[model samples]
Target chain A: MFTRNPAGLAALLTFVLSAAMVFAQAPNLGKPVSPAEIAAWDINVLPDGSGLPPGSGTPADGARIYTAKCSACHGPEGKGGPSARLVGGEPVKNMSSEKTIAGFWPYSTTLFDYIRRAMPWQQPRSLTNEEVYALTAYILSQNQLIGERDAMNAQTLPKVRMPNRDGFIVRFPDRTP
Target chain B: MNKTPSDRIKRELTDLQAVAGNGLLHRRALLRGGAALAGAMTGYTLLPSALGQQLTDDAWSRVPGSTVPDYGSRSRFEKDVVRTLSNPKGEPRTQHARTPHHLINGTFTPNGLHFVISHAGDPDIEPDKHRLVIHGLVKQPLVFTLDTLARYPMVSRMAFVECGGNSAPLFSPQPIQASVQALHGLVSCSEWTGVPLSTLLDEAGIDPKAKWLIAEGGDSPHLSRSVPLSKAMDDAMIALYQNGERIMPGNGYPMRLLLPGWEGNMNTKWVRRIQLTEGPGMTFYESRTYAAILPGGKAYQFYFMQEVKSFITHPSPGLAMKGPGFYEISGIAYSGYGRIAKVMVSADGGKSWAQAALQEPVHSKAFTRFRAPWRWDGGPAVLQSRAWDEAGYAQPTRTQLVAARGETAQVPPVTAFPSQHYNAIVSWSVERGGEVKHVYA
Candidate 1:
């Protein structure tokens, strides 16, 4: 087919040469890692419960942990405090209004994710998977989004619908996933 | 050629002319050299008394200078020029260090004074033990140490990382009385050198299903944000060096993820992992903290771009006009879209504007200094700057911006971020007494 058009043949040769040049430029220095080896550092939990660890807890277990570990900065039962209030929030009337789990959080999985990685500000990443699930259950239950007896696990955490789930509009829709 | 100093000064002063209303001189007047500009500075051309002072050797000129240290430091006289910290006590919360824009000039912010918003205090991470891993949704999960990343082919670029709420105080119904640093200082630029994220991702062999990548930091909070996979392939970098040295601890020592022109929080500091995934993580930072609330109660999520914005730094609040004879109104103009196309200066509110000259080699997404020659008559004047980006977006005026993004019902504290991504025109009113203050004109 190229014999009928010499220009087409030249174009194809140039494209192949440029593609080769591009492939040659990558350094390819990354050492292959195993999934088991990455587990220690892989703490991220997505909204779809992609990385949630296998654990379960109820609001009762979470209340005991919250009083012992979190009440100092977060105030008793996650009311207003020196830090941020985590429980009930007045509806977000304006931009300045306080954002709480019930008022503004979009996904319940984010609560589990944040608590697992950053809660109890001074001692971060100290909570076990079960403790994180319990805290998530307690916060959700306090916000009246979940029942007091509902045990939160990897399966149930992502299923809890947040009050402000549909409140957000992606500013740049075209640029997102 | 034999003219006296007075004759030359008078001639130069006479040559200067106003280009716009309220004594805005020709932009090229700055190019006329220091002697001419100096004469213009003093309302009168003749500085006979100053010129008559005897030229005696000063104490510093007579004695040898102090010994130099191994690491350089700015002059002690410049000690006052430093970042203002929001949490000096290092409390258990996010701390903000704002750059002093009025005190400094030029495009690149010094490494020591770069604005930092540390969720927890800066972590003291030892470079030797630090590891960077790329996993999830890739053909092969990969790991790289700091030393290995340093060996790769690296590129350098000047980029500005601006917080989504940099100038949030401007969202107040009434302009808050504050310095330019207090109002607009969260954004800063520096030359960042790093290996392209695409090169590393290419080595990992991306799966076709991967659409987003979650970048996490090694800081105590383990702060993380999900970035579009397309951006990672475009211009993202695993930046190792900032301003020709190892990155500062506050700015993410060892390494940080540099997403040029994106929200500041998304550029995770002390970045340790990049996990490619099928969708956004919808992490705490994105799902709540950075999401901006709009009028009618709905919020705007993923507002990534720091849009076209500019503010007069020299004559802004706290920098008095100094009897303003011929003052050059200058400040920073930048846009995430591209290079700044044009900047217009208005001495009398936004009624009439004179085009300001943009500094040469204006890099995309970096601070471009815009200067306008002004011959202020020392009367009441509301000074403002409006910038336009190459992408055809103009910085909206105060009235226009407030109409679109509602202002606070009550004035917010200067430190409060009521809303995010505020990129409107900033106005500074100059009084007859030469005192400049924040204004809503």
Candidate 2:
């Protein structure tokens, strides 16, 4: 290599050095984590139901869980008390009207995702996957969006189309990923 | 004897003429040493003082100061200048602490008085135990602790985090009689110093299929929001320090996700996890809480940016004018798109507008303070400020906004959110008696 022109050799060396400097900028202090180590904290469920866990429950099963764990704040049968009313809503005549599950929610997976992540206001994420599915089923059935006996699970939950499924218009399509 | 500062202020005022209707003076009047001259003669002329009183040392000047505290705090006299809390007892529901904008000035919101809306109240998180995990759609799953993150290359930027529901009360059919704090207190700006999220993501090696990332907090609610990967690669930061200090507990101590110019709800506080994915999670917030219903019954979804907005903070509701002489009309103007380009003050509602002077070094996505001189004529007038962003978007007038997004059927409570993303002009009516009230104009 030294037999080549001196300036050409120097240019090649400079190119390699600059690339090394650029790639080495980051401190790279993060520690590698295993899938098992992250299993406990990875609870997010997407609209496509990719993150939904192994669970199954019917509206009947959800009614019992809602009465025991959710009724105090959300009221009996999701009519709503101190917290938001989860069961019913009108035709959304104006912006100020109460937005209910039947009236505003566009995706059914959001019900399961929200209930699993944050519900029973006082204690969240303490419910099991079965309890979350049950509560989601109970609210959906109460809103007359699903059958009373239909079971909700990873496979069937995403299929339940909400009433307001076509009610949303993406505000900024260019910025949306 | 030297002429008093009040005499100098009066002499300076004589040369300034009204640039617009309702005695709106030129913006340069304040820059020409008018405010500084008026500052020296503030209390004596405004308050009832004995004539020819001799200058003497007051009690505070005669005594030594109190012992210094290990952690410095605001003076006791500033105790009343605090955030107004919606739920002081920490009830089961969400709690809100609104910043007192009228009582405070400048662009940076003090950490103590920064607005916070904790869904399940702030958690007492130990910094040592806290860990941030970034997994999914990455070449390698990585976990970072507070200590590890502190070692990364850091950058500081002044940005604003505004709640989507801020200024929602303006959507009511009639103006709500409330303070500026009650109406527009959910938004605040701070200088955040942090590690660029792209740096860490690049270290982890992002997968090409990843389109969005779900950010979750460590609070009880485990509040989560989905952000576009494009934004994460843009100006997003894992903010660890706010205003050169460790972040406040209420404002997400240890760390928080700071998505500059985005809706506040997307800036997940107490951020513990970021899971990259192919699509939006459509979390409860984006799906329901933040979606604003339009007049046609279709709701606006994924409305991330806080649009251009401005409101006069001085002489706002509850801040009555003092006898209607020379007054400096000042307020804040900001935008999520970019820097505020221009701010026009109209003393006659939307008619006869005059330009206001914008303070220098106007950082993008941060509050830009604007001031204009006005000689209040002790007559009825409507005060309004309209801002234009660098992106060329003008703040909408009340009629323009209401036409696009219909108003509420009934007047809403000051705290209730009638709609989301209510960015429009705010009008304050100055009565003949110098009292200012919220008006629709």
* Model 2 TM-score on a 0 to 1 scale: 0.94
Report lDDT (CA) for all predictions: 0.88, 0.89
lDDT of 2 by residue, A1-177 (tens): 656789988988999999999866988999999989999888888877888999899999999988898888888868889889999887575687788889888899998888888876777878999989988888889988889998999999999888888988888544321
Model 1 lDDT per residue over B1-441, tens place:
599766766776688766677888777777764645666466466555756668899899989999989999999899999999989999888899999999999888999889999999999999999999999999999999998898898999999999888998988888899999988989999999999999999889999999999999999999999999998999999999999999999999999999988899999899999999999999999988988887777888888788889999988899987775768789999988889999999998988888998899999999999998887777999899999999888998878877776877788778876647788889999999999989888
Q: What's model 2's overall lDDT?
A: 0.89
- The reply for model 1, stretches above 4 Å from the true place, is A1-23, A173-177, B1-16, B37-49
Instruction: Tell me the deviation in Å of residue A8 in model 1.
Output: 15
The CAPRI category of model 2 is: medium
lDDT of 2 by residue, B127-154 (tens): 9999999999999999999999999989
The reply for model 2, stretches above 4 Å from the true place, is A1-24, A173-177, B1-15, B36-51
lDDT of 1 by residue, A1-177 (tens): 999999999999999999999866866778999989988899889888989999899999999999999888889979967888988887676677777779999999999989988877988989999999999899899989999999999899999999899998888643321
Structure candidate 1, residue pairs in collision: B23-B375
Chain A superposition TM-score per model: 0.86, 0.86
